[model samples]
Target: MAFRDLAMAMVYFSQTLIGTVGNVLLLYHCSCLHFTKSKLRPTDLILKHLLVANSLVILFRGVPETMAAFGLKDFLSDLGCKLVLYVHRVGRGVSIGSTCLLSVFQVITISPRNSRWTDLKLTAPEYVSIISILCWILHMLLNTIVLMYVTDRRCHKNITYRKEFEYCSTIRQQKSRTILHAALLFLPDALCVGLMLWTSSSMISILYRHKLRMQHVRKTNFTQRSSPETKATKTIILLVSTFVCFYSLSSIFQALFTLYNNPDRFLVNVAAVVTGGYPTVSPFLLIKHFPCISNLTDCVRNKKTYNVKRIMQLS
Candidate 1:
């Protein structure tokens, strides 16, 4: 391989490894909680689902690109290509749906007692399993077109039949089919985006009102008092924003690849990287925002602070 290709391969290898390990840790943490805890919190419910979705995304999306980066593009058979690409697409769709659910659930969970959604907080926990299963089935059905369209592009001497794949060919679609499926997929994506925006906005507004009320009641300088719910909201917001940013970036790059006859290999890699980037980074962000984790960090900081004091006393 050329120096550039080798470097790209290394980049992908490192990212995939990091992403895999991070997601595995997340999965392990959630699994332990699920099995050991008496009851799963709603937040944990969403998080566990998100972790599974992210792991699949990282595995399916990152592995192929990493292999391709190292110059092993033609290794997949037609059936293998179909299965890999189909699973990857389904994983991405599930991740999107899971994020939307998490965001909306947090908003509802934190809603004011008198608010319209207040009643949902009690009932939402019951529906989590059903909603998640529906999300899986819905996305699975929506993306089955991949099975029909994704074929091995490696040995195709006829370039016309080739579809776009992550490391290889993707689903070959004509203008009509492309437009139709895009519309179908966009309906859910658009719904998710809309729901996330509204829920996030509502939570922000609630926070603002809450702060003002606290200030009024105290009649003193406002200090930040964050609840566990607030922390979860922040985590959900960060995950949503990160997912949306990467999702858009990857889509734009993919679009550009289709538009241009000769697209840069670096751009392709960047797009592929963005595809797996959020799944890589989101677990760390989630861990960072957890109340227990933050408290543990604070304890460590305090221990260090005390150690410094002891050293000074000894001196």
Candidate 2:
């Protein structure tokens, strides 16, 4: 393999490994909490969904791309190609949807009680699980259209097909039909991204106001230390910002690839890397702020204390 290919493969391999491990660890922690009957916040439930979606995105996208980068060929069957691409599309949609939902939830959470959103703030937690389930269903149904287009690269060598990935080829369609399909796929993602932008702006506004109020009341400089709400809001804002940046770059690369008559391997590789950026990075952001670490530490401390008490009693 060329140096460029080797480098790209290494990048994908690193992203896949780190992202998968981080998501799984956090997911396992969340599951343990659920099974142990620990109280979970509404945000926690949304986060669990996000983690699962991120894991799917990383695994399906990263693994295949890495293999392809390493000069693998015709490894997937037609069914395998369809399944991999379909799941990747669904996972990407769900990841976007989940992030949008999380932002909306945070905005509702931090809204002033006297505001018009009070009722939603009161009731949103009850519906988080339902909303997350609906997101998954919506994406699953929407991406079924992908199955009709995607096939293994080797399956259609004699026919004219657009090479979407190293292992996946998509049947070319009429211009109008292709446009329609593009619109159908783009609309939902656009809606979710728009929602995220709006919610993130609102959160920034709310945080600013809260900061001002705190500074006024305390008559001192607001330090790095902040309330849990402020910290959570900041984290979501950062998350949304990161998603928007990476998503926009990936979209631009994809558009260029589509418009060009013959896109280079570098363009395709860059797009794949940009596409996987959010999934690979977001998990670490979440893991840093996740309460699971503290919970685990507390459990260990309690266990040690109990053992010491037993030893004392025996002596």
Candidate 3:
């Protein structure tokens, strides 16, 4: 393999392994086995869904990109491409929806009691299942069109108009169908990003005001800034920021590919880099926020270090 391909393979492998491991651990802790509480928070419910989505994204995206880096071509059959790409898109759409829901719920949770959204805070947990079902239904419906163009046909014969999926042949769609396809893919993305921005901004505002109130009340005393609501809002903001950055970068590369009719390897690599950002960063951000996770991480790290030291002494 060329140096570039080797580097890309390293990036893909490391991100895939780290992201999958962290997200799996997060899922386990947030599942029925909660060491810290008897009941899960509404946001925790949303996060469970996000973890599943991120795991799927990591698997489909990381595996293909790594195989391509090592010069493995056409490893997927027609049915495999359809299933893998469909699941990837669905997972991505669910991730976007879950992030939006998480942000909105956090905003409601922190809103003043007399605010218009107060009712949602009290009842958000009840609607979690409904929201998850709607998200899956919407994405599954939107992604059904994937079956039309994804195939195992040879694509190198006409490289000028072909989009570069690892194991799929590109087929031309009608103009009207193309517009509808774009709408189906990008409409929900735009809505999710807009909603997240609005809600996350509101959360930051509420957090700032709360900080000011705390400062006023405890001007003469030392106070902790680590209230549960405060910490949760901060985590939401970090997650949203990471998502926006990666999503924007990927979309820009995609637009460039479309404008130029086909992208070279470098642009494709840049796009691939964006795919790993959120799945890798989110788990660590969440780990620091949850006390249970923090304790778990410390114990694991200590044990691993002890094993390494013992191995060195033996060697």
Candidate 4:
């Protein structure tokens, strides 16, 4: 493989492995075991669903793209292309919705009793499920048109307008894509950003109150910052940060591809880099926020160091 391909493969493999492992552990912890005294809380359920969605995204996006990066021929046939792309898009939509719901839920859950958000926690979980179902249905219907338009081009052939292939959409359908793009891409993204901003602002206000309380108390407990509420805040911050980084990078590359009529080589490479960001960072984020995970990490690190010292002493 060329140096570029080798580098891309490393990135793709690492991200896929790390993201898969981290999300899988998170899923197992929340789903198969009781990590908290609270039984099957709304946030726990949301995390489980999010991990499933993320795992699907990694599979559909990471595998084929990695093959293509290594200069392989079209592994994804026409149906594969349509289905994989469909699942990736739908999974991403669900993830965005779930993250938004997580943020909103956290804000409400952590809000003071007098705050407006407390009223939302009572009903948010039920509505979040309804919204998830509606979102899946809507995204599936919107992407069905993709199968009608996309077909398998021959090996090593780039996509180009061909007269013989009636599979390429008519002018009317092309116009429809414009409308669908606005509906699917712009609307959902805007809503996510709005929700994130609201949640972040609320978190800031909470932090301000925390600081003020810390200042007034001369001998306050240092452990207050390490409480469950604080840990949850940190976890949400990590989630938001990862979401923004990955999605923003992908969106930028996609826009450049469309606007500049760039070569697929450049666009694909950018996409590969952007896509791996989530899986690569997710494990570290989980490790950082969870005390149990921190303890486990420390134990592993100390064990390795001790083994190394013993070997040196024997030498």
TM-score, every prediction: 0.86, 0.90, 0.87, 0.80
Model 1: colliding residue pairs: 163-170, 164-169, 164-170, 165-169, 165-170
Query: How does each model score on lDDT?
Result: 0.78, 0.85, 0.80, 0.66
Q: Among these predicted structures, which one has the highest TM-score?
A: 2
Give, for candidate 3, the lowest lDDT window spanning 10 residues. Answer: 31-40
lDDT per residue (tens digit) for residues 132-181 in model 2: 99999999998998998788877736666475567677787778987898
Output the number of the lDDT-best candidate.
2
For residues 97-158, write the lDDT of model 1, one tens digit per residue.
Answer: 89999998888988899999978978998999889989999999999877766677665556
* Lowest lDDT block of 10, candidate 2: 216-225
What's the lDDT for residue 65 in model 2? 91
Off by over 4 Å in 1: 155-167, 219-224, 291-315
* lDDT-best of 1 and 2: 2
Q: In model 4, which regions exceed 4 Å deviation?
A: 34-38, 126-128, 155-176, 222-224, 262-264, 288-315
Residue range with the least summed lDDT across 10 consecutive positions in model 4 = 163-172
Clashes of each: 5, 0, 0, 0
Superpose all Cα atoms of candidate 2 onto the true structure and report the RMSD in Å to 1 decimal.
3.8
As for candidate 2, its clashing pairs are none
Alpha-carbon RMSD, each predicted model: 7.7, 3.8, 6.7, 8.3
Error of 1 at 145 (Å): 0.7
